[model samples]
Target: MLTENESIIRFFKELGLEVTSIDLGIASEQERSSTIQISRDSYPGVEPHLVTIADIARWFPELTSSGDIRLKQPQPDVSNCESLDIYRQYWEQLLSVTDIIMGFLKEYRTRFSRGEYPTTSWAHYFMNWTHETWDSRRLEPAPIDSWICYVDPSIRPHIRELNEFGLITRESCSGHPDDHPAREPFWPYVMFEERAYPGISAHLFTLADMACWIPTYGRHGFDVSLEIPRDVELTRGNIESYWNQLISSTRQLMPLLEDYISTSGVDFYTNMSNPSLFRMPANFQCKDMSTTGDFSR
Candidate 1:
């Protein structure tokens, strides 16, 4: 375990090779008050009670191991309303600050591994790119209700109707529909549905087999819009390299993730313990304090 300040410093030092001085400078400008405000916004009804680093260390002693702070009893004077309110405010503020700190840390780790500080937000950009790629790659309009299933010899008669309706196109070729000019057979529209019982024997179709049949009979030309960038192609050799970098960055940020999960867990447990935290219908039973009979015993 480490002190809050020590943890913060260690995070920066570990990523010093990838982080710019300007990044650190910008992060330092985040004020304690702003963090508190954000926390209040996050949990609307709950008042924050303690926000300082020392207070956090006292409450969550697992964060530090210099001494056993967890053994100390937290004695609050309930008579002083002002003191209680102040404490709540500080606690809320600390939550917000910690969130911001973790976010920055994740961003730094991702950017470092990627070898670029994305000008736009990386998450938003990735989502948009994926959507665009999907749109460009889709050759034909999708059916309203498409499903895949196995094709039994008995179901061939029913499938003929599907073929007549132009729902499925079949072809024969071994290469990708977009890249291979070979007349590969595939069936995109024909979906195989499974029978609930083995005795039912409904026709089963694997995705590859379905794809093989599509180009053989399907109506549209191949769509090559989802082509990868020349520099970013996912070749067999480079795919693992990309994954390795991602895993490394994630491992480095595990501590922050653990802290966030622990904090949230504490909040959830606290809320569950307080029956007054929720407003229930009069007829509803409060399960937390319920004395229901146990059938297992």
Candidate 2:
């Protein structure tokens, strides 16, 4: 078995890539802090909590809702935004980081697969930053290309499972009517899928169609599917179960995902090391558990 560092190095070497000199210290620290925050929120008061947008909204309604009842409308639909320039800015920065990291992994994988010694710096950088932003919370939009590049193909099965469960919807990419360049190039020809849930749609894509549309554009010619859950009556119990199922599926796939990357010689780090980048965080972890399942259960 590969040590964590060795495994990372070997995985990248197998992809035939090189590492850059950028320090991942800040990113790693941010990720660790995010992890600790999530852990604390998840395990508060000796009980484990499920992480869902509704749960967070209930616990911190102030963050989500306006105080004046008259002024309150449904949450802003992130999908219908007339302009996403602000979101685009953040996304580009994140993608840049993913790119460098993945580039190194690709190079490392190329060397390793050929039975050659791997680059030491590449391995070290990966080990230091490997855990950074592994969870969904840190994953923002923008650097979606990196997410596609680094995500393990094994997760595709879970995506299919989610679709079967009515948690996601699969469609031809060309069917969507959105006209963004991101959406246009991949249309019609590529098969696509998307999440069916309203809450997750708002949180991740900031727009309802984003869970499906963004991937279509980012992946371009590749046939891809979106992974989202369907919105049912929001009850505490049902929401909890749905969240649990999704989280369980994601967690179960983590190891196999790493193995898949290693075996396939995919360069995850290089794809993620750049500053202007966006990609989905392929990993998921528990967060706050305060709300009863009724919020969406």
Candidate 3:
């Protein structure tokens, strides 16, 4: 299925409209997604359709056009009180407005970070770049590669246990510590061997596939995102009780990871060739909690 943004861009082509992402790198999430430039593709002389939320909302106001106002959510006013539900809006109708509004907000934030807002009080604000770790979706240039690896003292036993289970351990961290070097992720993670393709390392990938079936991995709130080529650098996530989460997942899921030995029924990860598979989606690690280790997730 086409994503909302992709589908809109596709329709834009039919209508002789076009969208493209451009860089004016005062970093914002928009650079990773959303259309920055939209223009008329067929008519070279026509001006770009630099539409905004107010404009688009006007274009599609039939639902709001003298219809049941109760269908929409009301803007709050003060009795020092409550809100009246206007119209219970529809998803598809709102999505078009959402894309344009999101792009607008992205630019607004980027400009604010750049201190371009016209307000004296804003003069005090400056670009606040902090140390951030982007997700590692790569299998190469791993920081370490060895069967004998040093992990957090708490995670060491778990590591040894997994290694003995035949999932070759590559790298792991037990999340933030008091003396945290600041380079490591704030969440705990394990990097195990995965088959780049069917060969000696195939079992590792098979085990990884089995891990996907362990219901406890998610039910217990273990926010572990699994990226293929399983690089330790970036395919990481944050968690509460991170070590306990790691230990519990190992203890509870081991039997399950081990039981599914036969590859006959397995769905081996099929998109190992895509480079993006090696990297977690943007802001995935930045999230405080997330979904499972399935490469598809």
The best-first sequence of candidates by lDDT reads 3, 2, 1
Query: Would you list the C-alpha lDDT of every candidate in the order shown?
Result: 0.26, 0.26, 0.31
- Which prediction has the highest TM-score against the true structure? 3
Candidate 2 achieves a global lDDT of 0.26
lDDT of 1 by residue, 131-202 (tens): 222222212423423431333322243344433332242311111234224554231123321111110000
Q: What are the TM-scores, per candidate, against the unseen true structure?
A: 0.22, 0.19, 0.26
Each candidate: how many clashes?
A: 47, 83, 13
Better candidate by lDDT, 2 or 3? 3
Q: So what's the TM-score on candidate 2?
A: 0.19
* Residue 41 in candidate 3, Cα distance off native in Å: 36
Q: What's model 1's lDDT at 190? A: 33
Please provide, for model 3 over 162-202, each residue's C-alpha lDDT reduced to its tens digit, 9 standing for 90 to 100. Answer: 65554455566655453256564444556554321111121
